[model samples]
Target: MKSAVEILSALAEPTRLAAMRLLWDGREHCVCELMRELGASQSRMSRHMSVLRNAGLVVDRRDAQWVRYRIAPDLSAETFALLEAALALSGKPQRVAA
Candidate 1:
C-alpha cells in the first residue's frame, strides 16, 4: 500500500496523470502505445510509468519485447476513488482497445 501523499505526488505531474487516465478504461497499454498517444519520447514516458509503478498505482508485465502497464488490481477503494475523481476532472474520452 502507498501513502496518499505518495500517490498524489506521483499523479501531480501532467504526463503521469495522463498515463493514469489512459489506464482508467481498464486496458493495459504498452510503452510504445503510450509514447505515441502522448506524443512523448520513450525516455519521458518510461520515467512517468516508473513513477506510477513506484507509487503502486500501476503494475507492469512483460509481453515479449513490450512492457505493458495497467492499474494495479489490488488498489484500495479510496485510492481507486481518487483516481476516478481525477479521471472525471480530466474529461478525456475513455480508451477503447481495438
Candidate 2:
C-alpha cells in the first residue's frame, strides 16, 4: 500500500506522468514501445518505470527478453480516483507506439 505522498511524488515528473497516462487504458506496454512513444532512451524509461513500480502505481512482468508494464490492478479506490483525476486533466491524447 503506497501513501498518497508517494504516489503523487512518483507522478510529479513529466515522464512518469506521461507514462502513467499511457498505461491508463489498461493495456500492457513494452518498454521499447514506451521508449519510442515518449522519445526517451531505454535507461530513462526504465528509471521512470521503476519509480511508478516502486510507488505501486504500475506492475511489470518479464516477457521473454523484454519487460512489459501496466497500471497495477490492486490499487485502492483512492488511488484509482487520483489516477482518474490526473487522466481527466491530461485532455490531450497520448501517442502510443503501435
Candidate 3:
C-alpha cells in the first residue's frame, strides 16, 4: 500500500495527472509520445515520470533502448478508483495511435 504522502505527491502536478490519465486504460506509452502530447521538455517530463514511478502509481518496462510506462497493475483498489475518477475529468479525448 502506498502512503498518503506518496499518493498526494504523485497527484500533485498537472503533468503527472495528465500522464496518469493517458495511462488509465492500461496502455503502455513511449516516452517520446508523452513528450509530444504534453509538450514538455524531456528532462521535465522525465522528472514527473520518476516521481510517479517512485510513488508506485506507474511502472515501466524496457524495450531495447526505449522505456514504456503505464499505470501500475498492482495499484490498490482505492487508488485505482481515485485514478479512474481523475481520468474521467482529464480533458484529453481518447486517441488511438498506430
The lDDT per prediction is: 0.86, 0.85, 0.80
**Candidate 2 runs further than 4 Å off:** 92-98
lDDT of 3 at 36: 90
Give the residue spans of candidate 1 off by over 4 A.
92-98
lDDT for each residue of candidate 3 in 1-98, tens digit (9 for 90 to 100): 88866787788799999887777666899888789999999888889999999988899988886678988889888877666665566664453431
lDDT tens digits, residue span 1-98, model 2: 78888988898898888888778778999999899999999999999999999999999999998899998989899997777776667673543432
Q: How many clashing residue pairs are found in candidate 3?
A: 0
What are the models' TM-scores? 0.88, 0.89, 0.82
**Residue 20 in candidate 1, Cα distance off native in Å:** 1.1
Ranking by lDDT: 1, 2, 3
- Report the alpha-carbon TM-score of model 3 versus the true structure: 0.82
Name the better of 2 and 3 by TM-score: 2
Clashes per model (N, Cα, C within 3 A)? 0, 0, 0
- Give candidate 2's TM-score: 0.89
Those runs of model 3 whose alpha carbons end farther than 4 Å from true positions after fitting are 89-98
Could you report the Cα RMSD, in angstroms, for every candidate shown? 2.6, 3.5, 3.4
Q: State residue 34's C-alpha deviation in candidate 1, in Å.
A: 0.2
- How far out, in Å, is residue 89 in model 3? 4.9
Q: Candidate 1 — number of clashing residue pairs?
A: 0
